[model samples]
Target: MNGLSLWDHLSVIRDPCQQWKIELKLADILFLTIAAVIGGAEGWEDIEDFGHDHLDWLRQHGDFENGVPVHDTIARVMGMLSATKLQKSFASWMQACYDVTEGEVIAVDGKTLRCSYDKGKRKGAIHMVSAFNAANQVVLGQVKTSEKSNEITVIPELLELLSIRGCLVTIDAMGCQRAIAKKVLDKGADYLLAVKGNQPSLEAAFNDYFRLDMFQQEDANGYSIQEVGHGRKETRLSLVMEDLSILGDLEYEWPALKTLGIVGSIREERSQPVKELDITVRYYISSAQLSPKEMLEATRSHWSIESQLHWRLDVGMREDDCRIRREQAGENMAAIRHMAFNALNSDTSFKAGIKRKQKRASRNTEYLSQVLSGLGLS
Candidate 1:
């Protein structure tokens, strides 16, 4: 929060509180700015600790709330802020922080705040869908959903708010819905949907037709094939057709179906090396007319959402261990963690995970200031 420059830039977009009181605006900004700097801050106590520790620097930077609102005041104001309005404003604020590169691969994934579940009350936990730019390693945006609703519903809602015109969206099987595909196309982006049992018939048909047309070269259109293996898994593949004919009588609207393929793979782990296993054939549909190399790149890049983003959150940022579950506190804190993740990743020269980056930031104020400046926060 030492840098008020980013907050000042966000203020220009729209009044943070045309509906709420001005005190609430100050409290919200102060809380979020601090949250961005220090992850895992929840409620008044955490913010108070942050303020107390950073008081001198915050005062020097004009980032401290006037008179340093007490913990109770901070808690009350946070409780009063409308969750919907705050989410919307925060989404807008994040859009201005990073530039979305053209043809960027935006990976969409969901994670539940495990501690948000109240077992005594039998209430469900908070679930959120996050859109991360795989190329830049930045979290573009996140949308919180009701505990009972699946991410399929929330993903589309989050997608509707983004501008991914030329980007290729990579999502897991949970997001492989026709409606979701249409929404992505409607937003002027392409999709690389993972085929799974959720769409049983579609998955079955794709597998069937792909196997039938494997070596026949039925379509005169462009086609290529490649095989790769690393670690413990090896994949043998063929991409044959380039038309909707691959979908064949499925009755799903696939206006963007341009490529079809069969991905066959075998796995042999260190513990089970003797028993080589051949998994079921996997299928995929892409909107982009990509070459074999591009398809492989897109497919491999999709896993970064898991390895780079989610793994970092769980291990590096300790997201799964968070126990804050009051109103929007869980959702808000998750967004702050993502913000920190992006900030740390953007500081590529740091050459370490979030925890180490934070330690470095905490130990070196000048370096931390430089990071904030890079984020347009200073």
Candidate 2:
């Protein structure tokens, strides 16, 4: 078996380990951990177990000459690593694997790592804001909020880390600030932000401009999507306005405010002879001069981050169940989990869910190597 090597840039992150006590190279240990996580190792003990069980296969990737390190040693090593540095390195690696294309929609959203809190240390759970490629289903980058900060501050920092040129950056109401809009524009990207109570004036502007009567016109600028499945029918309508003659003073506050939009949804459930209907409406703001159809697709695409990235992390990976709270251990582990996600998704030969892929990685050495090759770690 041949030892794997990391890309030069990823290998450049400085090791925080004590030189005299170092038995394994930092890159080797980091990659080893990523491989274990992909194979369903949830904690240090699981990782150590994985290493021992697959030491011979692991040797193809690194010098496990002394065998797998103890669980505490693995924890200690990760504890000493800088979360910020690890994120930067991970972001670079993601860019290397996935290329952002022109007009690609990249959704930015935040999720709280629920089980990462330490009561004895009086620490709260960590909130990670991630930038995800909607079309490609790849994580472009992520940033963690500091002890006393919120997503508003971390979001822009995360945006600055990515190759966002010629992309559409979408965010929820929490990121609808003028500063965030300008930041996206400055990065050579367009903004598609949801308008809600957080932006009181903007939401009011959208509400004021879009009265129910306007939707009655035959030439109303809007697009609609319909889905029917299992005794239910769902329809989504997106309405876009190019002339912000209705925006009043609110128009100037947002940068490149070319259009204001609204989306309405109606769902019908069939049980009796008659059907019941449920309807909802939402507002949005965009910097790009897009048509209603374009607006609809971009808006719909934004949810991919939740469905593709966050859902998989919680459901398949059991991210919420993990309790690896110690210094930078939790943060580092989360980043590695993401790496595992990227690696697993890269391989199409394994035609199954993430859980099945992990099970295969555990039992099939050759398949594990193929998965690691996705990160260029094998």
Candidate 3:
């Protein structure tokens, strides 16, 4: 197929013309979509400049049909698109471009577009919940939440939208609720949740039961422990305690509490050394009884959501500082940015930072076209 013909597949899902009364063909819309993201088109005007500058190359690559629409048309079409419809279409595209891996680690995290807040209107910024596949580095789906609601309320809805069978789901303290744990189990997936002040009773029970003195006692069987201090942080650890007898009197049924742990870390600066300690206890509810290595691997995989996904989107891609707050445009644009980031990350040859990759693609139309072609978005 030619570079732009892939849009025909997506057109079956949503017709831009019917939705927005735009006269452009699917190819034009697809080009603008890819260009807007990869070209660093902050808004409609940037997309227009990108299209106008790349017109000759676009025409050469494939049939232009009615030719590229002006920037105003691009803005109008994007503005007119129903956010819900766009999200659905994006989800469909994600499922098409990527396949869910068996035993995949799907991490759920929430982010707020800081610049998306409209202070004049006294409204909260767009806060979105994103589910990411840690292994494949692909976004599974995203849901927008009202400013007042926390991630706890939206996480279940996001999980309901995904097919997570055989996947390991990880979440922060906010999601460490019984209802959420039941939801994960009901979906045929295992869960590893971090304990914090929110579950004070559970935290204290786990801590008191696994206190340091308890490990030094004669009854510490089938339990191994290890500790590490690096970069001015101290981490305390214990492993593979098959028995939960110490936690017998807890009011809640923690059948999933196969292994419990506590981590404390301190930070030191040039001027002063600040001591900070956090007592975190977690429950590992899995279909497969994992060995110590397997459990540790799964627990460590949690940081991929931060290192591979969130960190990249914020620091690498500058997503947090984006100032596009028109209706759902900010969230919609952020989703597109994520799609672009995944596509770029999957391309081994394009190995620079996201900004550099985007600049290189924008400066070289052939490279940009090739990247989009691989994504089935040409």
Which candidate has the highest lDDT of all?
Answer: 2
Q: Estimate each model's TM-score.
A: 0.83, 0.95, 0.81
Instruction: Provide the lDDT at 327 for model 3.
Output: 65
lDDT of 3 by residue, 1-378 (tens): 123333544455454457465467655665576666776666667777777788787776556667777766765556555666556656666666666766777888888888888899887888888888888877877878866247888788778777788787888788887888888888888777777778787777666665545434565442343454444443433344545565565534653545554332223433445554444435443334556555556666777877888888887677887777766567668777876876677666776887788888889877787777766765
**Model 2 has how many clashing residue pairs?**
0
lDDT tens per residue, model 1, 172-274: 8888888998999998999988888998888877766654344345553323344444545454444534656656676446657676645554445544556
In model 3, pairs of residues that clash are none
Residue 198 CA error for candidate 1 (Å)?
2.1
TM-score of candidate 3 against the unseen true structure: 0.81
Q: After superposition, how far is residue 242 of candidate 2 from its true place, in Å?
A: 0.8
* Best model per TM-score: 2
Between 1 and 3, whose TM-score is larger?
Answer: 1
Question: Model 3: number of clashes?
Answer: 0
Model 2 TM-score is 0.95
Local error of candidate 3 at 213, Å?
A: 5.4
Question: In terms of TM-score, how similar is model 1 to the real structure?
Answer: 0.83
